[model samples]
Target: MWVKQISVFLENKSGRLAAVARLLADNGFNIRALSIADTSDFGILRLIVNDPARAYQVLKDAGFTVSETEVLAVEVPDRPGGLAGVLDLLHDTGINIEYLYAFVSKSGGNALVLLKVEALERAVEVLGANGIQVQDYHIVHQI
Candidate 1:
């Protein structure tokens, strides 16, 4: 299944990140997971929130550059090499991972990996055929 991810482009300055966080909090958005990639001038703030559409509109109205992407939330084991195993599966299937970020699940048993990959449909199929659990958006939204 696909998960909605919101990406905000932020100027690299103090308090910018805080401002976004405050904005989301003020709007009652629960951040399920987030990752930041930064350079000298700007940064990309990727987020999985309870409400992606609302978050996007709010950020846009606030003058923050934003975009939405479809990513996968995969349930992987919490032990050593858990992630490696998934990577290996993708690699063997020739599915290139664009990027990934992970967080411990709120339920406290498994790790949830947010993955952006080339050939999304194929990746999902491969993961499914291999018995990997790709979480649905409905489940992730409640986290």
Candidate 2:
């Protein structure tokens, strides 16, 4: 399954992050997961929201630098080794993961992984062949 992620380039200044969040809130976007990679002068705000296209548009309209990226959303068991198992499958298939982050369900019984890969199609194929379910964009965006 492919999910759209919004990557926003932000300066290291107060209210910058809040402005972005407020824009999304005003546009009716509910963020599902978020991560920020920071540097001395700037940061990258990576987010997965309910409405990615709209979120991107909102950010763009607000004068924020943004980009849309396709990523994989995978469901793995909450128990130990579940994530490892999935990674092992990908590694065996020679799929290189660029980056990944996790979000847990309310019950803490499941873990959803947001993954960026070098080759999306091949990653999906290999993961699917290994009995790993790849969530559809529809389902992912809704969640």
Candidate 3:
């Protein structure tokens, strides 16, 4: 299943990150997971929130450059080589991973990873066939 991810384009200025956090907090949106990629002048803050629709609207209304994307929340074992196995499965199936970042490993020794691939449907199909646990939004929230 696909999870909604919010991506906010932030200027590389002090307090911008805190402002977003405070806004979300005030709006009663809890951050589930987050990642950021930055340059000298700007950054892309990726987030998984409790309420994506609300978060998107709130960010847009506040004049923050933002967008929503579909990504997978994959469950991987919290052990050595666990990630490699998943990567190998995708690689063997010709799935191109755009980027990935670790999330809180709170699922009883199973780490949740936010993964993005070019071929969404194909990747989902392949991973499903291979018995990989692709987490849905409900499952992600509990984790």
Candidate 4:
């Protein structure tokens, strides 16, 4: 139904984020998408990588508090309003998106948007009912 995401606690200091990215990059983990929620002290770096298990291990081994979460990945047209259309649909259905980030899909003409919603099951059901496509694990892994 969705992909596993890595949430890394990072300090706001310079090079803290780079250290995490470098660790993943050096481990052959390809970052598909990422988002950062920051405050004055620290940040939560949400990441979708090629290998979630391995990525988690790498980060954990490096002494970082990392957690995995299930997130929805939706494929949309790579044009303007493509994202808006989906958001609008969700809004109209009373679904609230907590956060979202985009990634280039392996599927040529489409883009992947990783979303966190307030209600997981309900959101999926409503999105499907409204003709909005939600990506499964197999589809997301391919890209």
- Between candidates 1 and 4, the lDDT winner: 1
lDDT (Cα, tens digit) per residue for candidate 2, span 1-143: 58999999999999999999898988888888888989999999999998888888889988999999999988887789989999999988888888898754422356789899979999888888887777789877776
How accurate locally, in lDDT, is each candidate?
0.90, 0.86, 0.88, 0.85
Q: Which of the two candidates, 2 or 4, achieves a greater TM-score against the reference?
A: 2
Which should have the higher TM-score, number 1 or number 2? Answer: 1
Can you give the lDDT of residue 8 in candidate 4? 95
Encode model 4's per-residue lDDT on 1-143: one tens digit a residue. 87899999988999999999898888888888789999999999999887788889999999999999999998777889988888888899888888998866545567778999868888889778877778887667657
TM-score of 3: 0.94
The C-alpha TM-scores of every prediction are 0.96, 0.92, 0.94, 0.90
Error of 1 at 136 (Å): 0.2
lDDT of 4: 0.85
Residue pairs with backbone atoms closer than 3 Å in model 1 (clashes): none
Clashes of each: 0, 0, 0, 0
- Local lDDT at 127 for model 4: 74
Candidate 2 residue pairs in backbone clash = none
lDDT of 1 by residue, 1-143 (tens): 68999999999999999999999999999888999999999999999999899999999999999999999998887889988988999999999988899854643477889999968899889888988788898888788
- Report the C-alpha lDDT of model 3 over 1-143, residue by residue, as the tens digit: 68899999999999999999999999988888999999999999999988798899999999999999999988787899988999999999888899998886556568888998878888878878888888887777555
Q: Is candidate 1 or candidate 3 better by lDDT?
A: 1
